[model samples]
Target: MMKKVRVERDKQGFWTHPQLPEWDESTTFADSKKWFSEKGLDCALVIMDGDLGEQWGNGEIDSCLAWEPEINIQDAYLVGIWDTEDGVVAMFAFPQIILEDSDKAAEFKTDISGWVSSDGRFYGKDERLARYAGSTHRKCDCGNIIPKNSYCNPCAEKRTKEKFLAMPVVAWDGASYIYDENTDKYFSNPEELVEHYAVDDLDSSSAMLIVCKPNYARQIEDDFWCDDLPEDISFDECGGVEQETISLLNKLNEKLKTTVLSYSPGDQRLDQSLLF
Candidate 1:
């Protein structure tokens, strides 16, 4: 995957691409089209909140990029910056009317799928998060109206990295883990912990970054890696992860339902449940 040039927020809490011309009220649809074409980009982008993208995706608004007479370009920019999901996406559109006739460039939420995103990520929450210190709006520490008690998502990630680097020990796979004070041992991964205790201990009060499979890892992240998991569960990305997890869980569930344990508790043998 090509690395995405994540846009940074200026002091005013605004995100601007160094390569693209900034859009203002005086700008026009022709201006937006020019911005798209100048970058040799393929299309125009709209990013409004809620059902707007859904409506457009289902083909409800084919001619939604309606222009206005006074400030088509400026209002579009304001609406996008002030309120929207995927701020400043790209699109391939031409005004049906002449440049002078329309006031706005894109009157509705635009389709981001048509935009030029060389990066693998779809430009929405991820882009919005990155634009404002891993936050969604201008109110955050990066650029938000109200400051939050907890660190923004990106800041939390930085904190996690700092903790990981500061750690003095790690398991064979090189992952960081918490020490079991009672047992006087620490596990770098979940595979070691699961066998030593009951199933509930896997995700109990103890928090850790667990690697179930080579490609699958889940971090019980909160204040610290050892902090309790958040009470309210929220998904990070659901586009395809939901299906992928469902499939993987089904396989794991099938095996668990069929497999039988041969070793009793505390047996001096390999925990063969991992083999199944």
Candidate 2:
């Protein structure tokens, strides 16, 4: 007679060998698939000893038992072969089923075990067997990957400064300008600019108002008024006035009640104007 197998179950569902830990039967099959797939193996199986199998086997005293054709035993057997080869004898009881009129079979002890089959060989529950069972796919930028939430550390600071400069302005005068919630003070030269605020502290303000000559202002927007006059405030050729320089002087005049004077290069000239 073919060796009849037995099955058994514990309060937790199934009894396994003392050395072999019990796993949730529902997730066990899915985990087995993943375990095998990661290892690039063909199939996976789980087995238990007959002593552990009695718990799952039906209590029937029969010599010949009708095996369920629907239950795929091939994969289980393949896994069993691997387990047996690995010296895990407990795996044999994994698929124990009762036979009809097998009284002696019911008396056999059944225990739980697990196994996997790959390359025509069976293997026991070894860490190496399930090491690479799953695909390691990673998502793109928006996903939960490192350094994708914002610009990298170095770029983040520069981006933050650019964004801060784009904010709307509240008010700006000849001496100081206010943007967003920060204030910036103007200085006549780079030396004065550095003296009032340290280089590192400059980033604390939203903007810096630098006073420059009209010629310099041509290239860049004038953030504040410069007390110094243009080289040729009066248009000698036009005699009457120079429209561009006069317009710039008028704007500065409106902001500050003072006279405008033309200071030639390399010439020391100082003049004061009184407003009515």
Which model scores highest in TM-score? Answer: 1
Summarize candidate 2's per-residue lDDT along 1-276 as a digit string, tens digits.
112244443333323333233444354556754444444332334443353334334433221122211223322322222123222222332222212222311221123243322222223454233222211222233433221122343345466556544544222223321121123343443345445456546542433332222221222223232324344442323344567875785676565544323211211111101100
What is the C-alpha local distance difference test score of candidate 2?
0.32
Task: Evaluate model 2: give its TM-score.
Answer: 0.15
Residue-level lDDT of model 1, residues 32-150, one tens digit each, is 66555444232345454346446645656533343211233311222122213333233323222212112221121256532212222334434332233322113344542322223
The candidate scoring highest on lDDT is 1
Alpha-carbon TM-score of each model against the true structure: 0.20, 0.15
For each candidate, the alpha-carbon lDDT, in order, equals: 0.37, 0.32
